[model samples]
Target: MPQTIQGFSRLNKEEKIDWLTSNFLSDSQNATSILKQYWNSDAKLQQLHDEFIENTVTNYYLPLGIAPNFVINNKTFAIPMTIEESSVVAAASKAAKFWMSRGGFKAEILGTQKIGQVHFTYTGDAQKLSSFFELTKSILLNDLKTLTASMEKRGGGITSIELINKNDQLANYFQLHVTFETLDAMGANFINSCLEQLAESWQREYNNYPVFSENNAEMVVIMSILSNYVPQCVVRAEVCCAVSELTEADGIDPEVFATKFVQAVRIAEVEPYRAVTHNKGIMNGIDAVVLATGNDFRAVEAGAHAYAARNGSYSSLTHATIENGIFRFWIEIPLALGTVGGLTKLHPLVKLNLEILGNPSAPQLMEIIAVAGLAQNFGALKSLTTTGIQKGHMKMHLMNMLNQLDATDTEKSKAIHFFKSNKVTHSAVDSFIKNLRQN
Candidate 1:
């Protein structure tokens, strides 16, 4: 029998951590040990540690919110997200619930392969160098093969190779695109290592001296580098949901609502002004999960935005439509993420999170991420479609106001009620609190 997942809203912070440990971490003692490595007993130290964890170490506790009622590929999954924005979780949960009312989200993943690039540059004859590399392609490939023999044994190896001319104001440079089939791993480290070895061999073969710079390197006034951009793999997901679930207590057709929602996203995708806010919504969920799992959120953000504009047209990362009285959603992005090595091994909480995800392989992880991106996009669209996005958000913002006011439970309740009933104001909250006290 499978274990039950506890609802996040019901548990406090500490309880949530404990539950995560119980469900994900195989050994409580190990989890505690890992926690102790970073956490201190002193209050001030603990606070500093928390900041460090958020800023430097694994920032898993950003904002562990919930997206409930997700039925993907006919299986129910309650997504626990760590995002700072207010509307994303609520909107995703609402979308999931709406979909469940219909038949739930249906999704499928294409494959689990990422592209890595090997760029070559020199002042020498470009045509000659290309001819040299081509003549020695078999030998160079054999070298790469030897370097990645272990990976090849694991059913992964360099699948394709290409060369491109990147022209610029300074000079034209040659770029070598090395495509690899990385199975169950991010393959960054592996790809870089193999490329560096190949570069050394290329340097020996050609007198131009092939230099492998992770970043742009200064080579006697000319610079050449290898990067992580080769469009080798693609991941796709689709969701179809019903409209009635989107209806409030009052009767409203969610399919019509979804049309309006798509219009809002279209505005965001086209207009530069709305595009900023639109991308912000997508990042709200992406950064949170990236932070939670000890991954580099900044890189992911950069890559996502760059990909959004990859087609030379500013566009939304998602597409939504209404078909057969149901709302359909789709998303495609070049998400080059890793599951093994790097911080995934360094951070204990990330390990715990991955374990809770049931040790998903790289393909499975990519599939989950693709789904998350779609779910997040759906959520933003839903919010922009109805309720104006601020009403629900401001209600949650009341928590901060309550904290600032230092109001008790009853006082907070009264203040919120009074604020909502009337025009919200500081004076109004104070007046309501005073009235409550008098009563």
Candidate 2:
């Protein structure tokens, strides 16, 4: 019989690894390799290792935290995420607990398809390229058949292709939007490859025209290089718990809190300055997961901000409201992420983290991330509405400061006590340590 290891968090690093090896389900050898690689003493390797150990890489298995009570589309899922932020996990769990008091999170993914664009520009004739797309739309669609076949077999395919002339002066550009169902993957690479092939075809077909110069015509510019226009997959959670349940946690008025939270988001949507931070709050969760999974966080960041400003103004990624005495939350983002190829396979720790997730396919992984983002947003908004964001975040920062000081357990306790008492400073901590030593 397998022995149950209780409270692994209380154990030392080595003890935790040992427990993981004996009973926790994971790739033991891989896990051991990553631990050893970082635990070594080589300076450069050690530096990289330390970064990995921290929340630097999101996929480097720190702890698998779960947000329980998430009822999406009538199914309950314990959403597992790898993130190191202090209040994110706690807040999400709190939100889920609150929602459980009502009907839970009712969510639906509109479709798993994502759109990628290939841009064509020529000085001579926009009309010509426009006509060309009209004439060769079938050919372009047929070329994507192999690329999209697997998705097609799974009840998804390259559904539509459209050509739009972007009004611009530097170059007359035609944007081709290819929509394909990605099943459960993020679909960046798949969509990019498809667009690459399309661009190559455009070059071959329009090579004869002087204005369509490969050297000067700007024949292909893959704008929105990654997929956007994600079919709106709406995930919503509403709970009708008595205002009583709110008291058990922190004496928060669920109805009043929810109403105030919605108002804050409305302010963020209408105001550019607030919109920046509002979206940043969303990215706080997104960037954490993107880093953990070994995906390009910068790209996701760029895409998210661009998507927020798609309507010519910055706006909040999530909308919140209280209806019928229940808190309702909804989020939509251009989450361009992937599970196959790239860093997902290149990095050792990323592989380990994915394994912890049971190596979910792309779409499943996206769903998990989407929910995590929603949960994280809830965490931030709730904190801002109830207690203010800095209170909880600053306490976590104080703990980090103590860790950096390399204080002993006793020293840490003393330092924290002094810090809270307004007597702690760099010089003060030094004096306290010196006094302790002298005694």
Candidate 3:
């Protein structure tokens, strides 16, 4: 039975682990050993990792892979991907190689505006609030001088602020909508800090203005935060080639492949169930690169999914078409990523990953991430149209299954040889191992 304890956080790392294992785990010694096993060898580095979050226990790890021969904008790159899934890097690499011979990928940034808001409530005159906001907009900006000065010096700062009235949607609710140009940084902290300052100034300014005293109501500040759904921070990436070029050794006709591919994409666009899985494959590539580069994958994911449903229906983020003998595939996603801030500055692998990509700016990073998604989507759709998803995915998953079964070196070698000509599945591998051991 678990019991409450005071100041569990104040305990040392060892004490914390001891308490956790003693209270919760049946095998406390092994649990503690496992936790310590993942700790960094370098004490300083381990301390750095520990400081990343509160109640520090240990590190969690994922494999970092290199998907080579990605040619975007006529520039070749080997993107770094950090993920645990089987076949993601392989699929991405295959698609990248296929597109490399064609025109490669062309990408462009559509926009770079990020949004934050201050939610407040007031039963006062709506007209009076609007007029006051118009007059006090400069005051709000003036109050953020200290906050925006550094960002402005780098050619990015607050762009606009507007008063949004939402009384009909929710009683006495209003918003101070603000947009920003964050340049290279993801700017979550910067945006949030500026919003807090703006909120404080707004309350102070509203209280000082005696014109609001007639209403006998207070302007209540609800919350100030940056939004993860950044529709404006979007990028587009595409690949195009002659329909004949799509033909391969698999004997699938280029015209048939193109038709099937476009149909697959169309199904995803209309069917929410298919669209969800289709987009998951796209994010397999995007999230790998995003995580390897130390950006917020969760934020990018939320924004992308929200953008897919922006038209009142959840649809595919990727589009496809075959026009006049030209087959084209593309993806457009809202990815509010950063190359400079957050974990980029601290994690060693993130630094190297950024350098490997030639140190892209935030917009440039957005472009590369978008291209990864497109490449991954192409790989998945091509497999779905031609051989089938399982043929390659299960083959790639064979090693992981073998590892899980703890097959010996000789058993693993035999299993590899056998599965080369046979289909792979959990029961098949288990039976193969059992026969090998018995014989």
Candidate 4:
């Protein structure tokens, strides 16, 4: 049985590790060795990692890979990706190279608005609440000037604030829906702080209203926080080339391939079952770049999926079309990214990724992320229409399975050669290994 320990965070790093291993680990010494093995050789860097969060433990590492030959807006970039998935970088690189000769990807920022909300319950007359909001809206906006000054200096701050009535759905519920422009930072903390300040100002000013005096009812604020669903903070990435440009080495007609590709995208657009996986393939590229650049993949995922269902049905984030003797594939997604705050300035690899990406501004980063997604979709659709997804994906996945079995160098070499001509399946590899061992 384990016991809860108080003041656990007060313990130093080594002591905390000692207590954890002694109590929870079956082999305490081995566990300690394993944990220590991941520590950075540079003491200063290790200390920095330790202080990044509470209850410091050994560092965990993921492979950082570069997907090269991404040409966007006449400029070339080698996008960095941090992911555990084996084929994402390879697929993105293949797509980038495929488009490099076909005029590459073109990306643009559609908008750059983030949202926050202050929820409160008011039992007063709806008419009175609306009147009060109209009267006090400027007060709420003006009250936050001090908070917005720094953001304003950077050409971003509060964009708009509106009162929304939601009593029809939930009893006595109303909200202050606010919009913001955070130029380079992710702005979670900044948006949250401003919302809290607005709520405080509202509560203070509500008592002076004649409506509140007449009704003797208080406007109770439930909470104030930033929203991750930033539909307006959108970026669009597209690639287009002549239909005949989509030539095939496998002898399939280019026109047929282009038609199949468009149909595949349409299927994903209408069918939710395929759309989920289809969108996931897009995220495989988007999330990889997002993670590599040290932005929040979870938030990007939430906003993007919400936008996909903006038409009331979950659908593909990427769309494809072939018309007027040309084929075009593109994606429009809401991505809130930063180039200068949070982990961007802290993590070494994040800084390196930013440098490798030409240190794009928030909007530029959005364009990059969106292009990554579109490129990934193009790659997937190309394979899906022609060779089928599994043939290449399983081939890329071969190394992982081989690693799991801990095959020797000689065995791995043999397995790679064998799988080149034959299909890769776990049973086939297992039998191959078994026969190799027996012989």
Model 4, stretches more than 4 Å misplaced? none
Q: Candidate 2 vs candidate 4: which has greater lDDT?
A: 4
Residue 285 error, candidate 4, Å:
0.5
Question: What TM-score, computed on C-alpha atoms, does each candidate reach?
Answer: 0.76, 0.70, 0.98, 0.97
Question: Which residue runs of candidate 1 sit more than 4 Å off their true CA positions?
Answer: 1-38, 41-61, 168-170, 208-230, 241-251, 323-326, 416-439
Candidate 1: 10-residue stretch with minimal lDDT = 215-224
Q: Compare candidates 1 and 2 on TM-score and give the better one.
A: 1
- Name the Cα RMSD for model 3: 1.0
| Models sorted by lDDT, best on top | 3, 4, 2, 1
How good is model 4 by TM-score? Answer: 0.97
The best candidate by lDDT is: 3
Kindly list the per-residue Cα lDDT of model 3 for residues 288-321, writing each as its tens digit. 9999999999988889999999999999999999
Q: Write the per-residue lDDT of candidate 2 for residues 117-170, one digit (tens) a residue.
A: 787665556676677678777776777678878878877666778887775644
lDDT of 4 by residue, 88-190 (tens): 8999999999899999999999999999999999888888878888899899889999999999998999988888999999999999999999999999999
In candidate 2, what residue range of length 10 has the lowest lDDT sum? 52-61
Question: How close to the true structure is residue 243 of candidate 3, measured as C-alpha lDDT?
Answer: 91
How high is the CA lDDT of each candidate model?
0.64, 0.65, 0.94, 0.92
C-alpha lDDT (0 to 100) for residue 290 of candidate 1: 63
